[model samples]
Target: MRCVLIISKMQEMSNVLLIIQASLMGVSLTLFFALVLSSLQKTDTTKSYEIVRWLLAFAMLLFAVHYIMQMVFGFRAQGDDVGAVINILFYSPIAYILSYSILRIGCGNNYYRKFRIMSITGTVLISCTFVGGYLYYGSMHMKGALYIMGLLYFFSIVLFIIYPMKEIRRIRKMVDEESGQEPVLFNMYMRTCTKLLWISALCIAFSIFYTPLLVIIGPFFFIALVFYIVCFLALGYNIRQMSNIIVAETEDEVNADGVEAGTVAVKVVMSEERKEMTKALIEGWIKNQGYASSEINSTLLATRLNIPKRQLVQYLREVEGKTFRIWLSDLRLEEAKRLIIEHPEYSTETVAESCGFSRSLLQVKFKEATGFTTNEWRDNHARKS
Candidate 1:
C-alpha cells in the first residue's frame, strides 16, 4: 500500500484537462515551428517580410524554450518554484517584439528610435523585478513578492501593447496622404497580428500563476491557440497575402521605385539628383493639367509621369506639408478658378466638369480655398473682368 501510494502521488497523465491542454500546446508548437520555417524559406527579400520573420522567431523562441522546460519538469516545476524568474525573462523579449517588430512590418523606416529605448528599459525593469522577486519569494518564501513581480510584469506588458499604436495610426495617415495604393489588406492583417499580440499579453499575464507551465497548460494553452491562428494566416500571407497588403505599387514593376507606398519608402536612400528628377516630372505633369482628372491619384499620376510613385509622393509631401489628395485638390481649385475667370459664360457644372470637380465638390473646395462659394467667386471675378 505504501508503494502504491508513492506511485499515485507522482505527477502523471491522469488529468484529462492536462492531456488536452498538452495536446493543444503540441499543436501550437507544430504550427509555430512551421511559421518560423516558412519565414526562413520565404527569403528576406522585403522589409515587411523580414520584420514578420523576426516577430515569428521572437514568439517561437519564447514558446519553444518554455514549452520544453514545462514538458521536462511537469508539475514539479510548480512545486519547486523553478519557473518564478524565467517566466519574466521569456516574457520580456516577447513583449518587446510584440510592441515593436509587428509594427515595423510595413513602416520600418518610420519606426521611432525611442521605441527601442522604452522597450529595452521595460525589459531591464522586468529583469530587475524578477531577480528581486525570486530572492524574496523563493529564498525567503514570501509569496507577496511573487504577486508584486506579476503585477509589475502585467503593467509593463500593457504599456508595451499601447505605446506603439498611435504611430501605427500615423502610418495610415501617411498612406491616405501620399499614395493611391489603398492599404486595405495591410490594415486587415496588421489588425490580426495586433489582436494576437494583445491576446498573447493577456495570456502571459495570467500565466504568472503557473509560470513554469505557461507554454503548456498555462492559461489553458491560449497563447498556443493564438500562435496556431497566426501561423495559419501567416502561411496564407507568405503565399499571397504579402502582395495583397497595400495594392501593388505598379502594374509593370515589382515594387517599382524600390519603395512600397505608405510602407517601405526610399526617401533617405534616394539621391538628390533622383529627387530632382521626380520633382521635374511632377511639375511637368501639373503644368500639363494632369490634375484635371477626378480619377487621377498619386499612383496613376506617377505612372503617367513615367517616374516612380514613391519618389513622386515624397516630393509632393514636402511641397507644403500637404498630402497627395490635398495637393491634387489645390491644383484642381486653381484650374477651376482660371476657367471661371477665363470663361465666365461657362456654367458651374461646366467649369466643375472641366476641372475634374463634381459641381458640389467644386463649391465646397472653392469655398475653402477662396472663402467664396463657386458661384460667388465666379460672380466676383466676372464682375471684375
Candidate 2:
C-alpha cells in the first residue's frame, strides 16, 4: 500500500508539472507576439532596439520548441534531459531580456557589446549542457547545469546593476540640474527601469531558492510567470510612450513648417514692390532704432517693423535659424568684435558698453556664445588677424 501510494503521488506530480509547462508555453507564445508588436513600434532612430527584439523573438521560439518536445515525449523529473532544455530555454530569454533592456535603457554600444557577448556565451554554455545531458547523463546532470545557469544569471544581474548605476546617477544629476522637466518618455523609462532592477534582484533571490526546492518548485514558476508578465508590460508601456513622444515631436516640426510657409507668403508679397523700401526700412531701423541688447524684444521689433509679433518671431526663426535673443546676441557680439578690432584705442569694456551690453553681461554672453573668455577671444582673433 505504501509503494502504491508513492507511485500514485508521483503520477499526480507529473500531471501537474506537465500542465504548468503547457501553460507557460502558451505564455511564452503570447509574450512573443507582444514583443513583436513592441518591436514594430520602435522608432527609426532606435537601431539597437531592433536587435534586442529579434533576440527576444528567437529566445521565445526556442522556448516554445523546448516545451513542445516535453509535451510530446515527457519531462518526468529534474534530471530528465528535456528538463535541462526547458530550464535553459526558460532562463536564457529572461537573462537576455534583462541584459538587453539595461543596455537600451542606459549605456552605449560598448556596454551593449559586452551584454551580447554574455548572452551568446550563455547560449553556447546552455547549448553544450543540453547536448551533454541528452548524450551522457540522460537526465541526472541537469540540476548541476541549473546551478551553473544560476551562476550565469547572477553574473548578468551583477552586470546589470553595476553598469546602470553610473548612468542612473548621471541622468539623476542631469535631471536635477535641468529642474527635472525632461520629456515624459525619458522620465517614464527611468521609473520603469528602476522598478525592473529591484524586481530583478528579487527574481535572482528566487532563483537561488529554486535550486534547493527541486521537487516542489511550483510556486517559483508562478512567481516567474508573474514577473515576466509584469516586465514585458512595463517594457511595452515604455515603447509606446517613446513612440508617442517621437510622433508628437515630429508633428510639432510639421506645424512649424506650416508656420514658415505663411512667413514666406509675407516675404513674397513684400518682394513685389517694397524690395528697396524694405531694405532701407531695415537699414534705417538697424542704424537709428538700434535695439539695445537689454531692450531688444520680439514685441518691440514687431511694432517697429510693422509686422505681427508672431510673424516677426517666425521670420527670425525661419530665416536666421535663431530665436529673437540669439539673433540679437550674435548681432551685439559682432558689433563688439568689430569695435574691438577696428578701434584699438577703445578698451574691450568700452566697446562692449557701446555694443549695448553691460561690461559683465558682455563677458558672460560672449563666453557662452563663443566658448571662450573675452580675453581669449581677443587674443585668438588678434592672432588670426
Candidate 3:
C-alpha cells in the first residue's frame, strides 16, 4: 500500500512538472517572436544581427516542436516507436542550431562558412546512419540509433566549449591590437551563450542515460530555459543601444560645421598638396572639435573628416603607426595630464570632463599612460611644480 501511494505521488509530481515545462516553452516561443519582430522593426539591422535572429528563431521553433511532441506522445515511453523516431528527428537539430549560431557570432565570415560546411556534412552523415540503422536492425535495435545520435550531440557540445574559447582569444587580440578596453556587453553576451550551451548539453546527457530523471529535475531545466530567454533579451537590448549610439554619433557629425571637409574622396594616388591638405584638415578637426567631446569613436571621427572609416583607420595605421582608438586615447591622455599639472584647482571630475573622458575611463587611461593612478599622478606633478 505504501509503495502504491509513493508511486501515485511521483506520478502527480511528474504531471505538474510537465505542465510547468510546457508553459515555460510557450513563453520562450513568444519571446522568440518578439525578438524577430524587434529585429524587423530596426532600420539599420546589420548582417550579423539578421543571422543571429534567424538562428534564435529556428532554435525556439525546434523547442516548441519538441514540447508538442512530448505532450502528444507522452514523455519517456519507450514502448512508443513513432514517438522515439520523432525524438531522434527533432532533438539533434537543436544542438546543431545552437552550435552554428555560436560559431557565427564568434568567428569571422570565412571561418563561419568553413565550420558550417563541416556541420552540414556531419548532419548528413548522421542522418544516413539513423536511416540505415533503422532499416537494418528494426525497432528492437533503436538503441544503436540513439547511441550514434548521442555521440554526435556530445561532439556538438565539445564545439560549443571550444569555439567560445577561441572567440574569447580573438576578442582579446582585437582589444590589444586596436583599443585597450574590453567590450563589456559583448563579453557578457558571449559568456551567457557559453553557459547556456553547457547547461543544455548536461541536460541532454542526463536525459539520454536516465529519461525518468528529466521528470524529477524538470524544474531545473525550466530554470535554464529562463536564463536562455533572459540572455536573448539582453542581446537584443545591447543591439538597440549600439544602433542608437551610431545614430547619435552620425547626427553629431552632420551638425558640425565644415563636415564636408572630412568627406574627401578616396584617391589611389594623392598629390603631395592634397595629402598635406587632408592631413591638415584632419588635425584641425581633432584639435578643434573632437577633443572637446567624450563620445567620439572611429566612425564618428571619419564622418567628421569626410573620409571612409576604413580609409581613416588605414591612414592612421600607415602614418601614425597607431590604431584610431590608440591615437585618440593618446590625444585625450596628453590633454588630461596637462590639465592635471597646470590646473591644480580643477577637480578630478572636472579634468576628466575637460579631457573628454568619463571619470572611470579617465582613471584607467591615466594609470595606463602614466604608470600612476590619477590621484598619484596629480600629487607627483604638484610636488614637482
* Model 1, runs deviating above 4 Å: 1-17, 75-86, 110-112, 136-142, 210-323, 326-385
Candidate 2 C-alpha lDDT tens digits along 30-63: 7678777765664453555566566667666666
TM-score of each: 0.55, 0.48, 0.67
Poorest lDDT segment (10 consecutive residues) of candidate 1: 242-251
RMSD of each: 11.3, 17.1, 8.9
Candidate 1 vs candidate 3, TM-score winner: 3
After superposition of all CA atoms, the RMSD between model 1 and the true structure is 11.3
Of 2 and 3, the candidate ranking higher by TM-score:
3
Candidate 3: C-alpha RMSD after superposition = 8.9
Each candidate: what lDDT?
0.62, 0.57, 0.64
The candidate 2 region of ten consecutive residues with least summed lDDT is 240-249
Screening candidate 1 with a backbone cut-off below 3 angstroms (N, C-alpha, C), the clashing residue pairs are none
C-alpha lDDT of residue 57 in model 1: 60
- Please give, for residues 107-191, the per-residue lDDT of candidate 1 as tens digits: 4444646677777876787677667766755652436665665676777777676656765675566556643332344457657
TM-score ranking, high to low: 3, 1, 2
Two-way lDDT contest, 1 vs 2, winner: 1
Which candidate's lDDT is highest? 3
Ranking by lDDT: 3, 1, 2
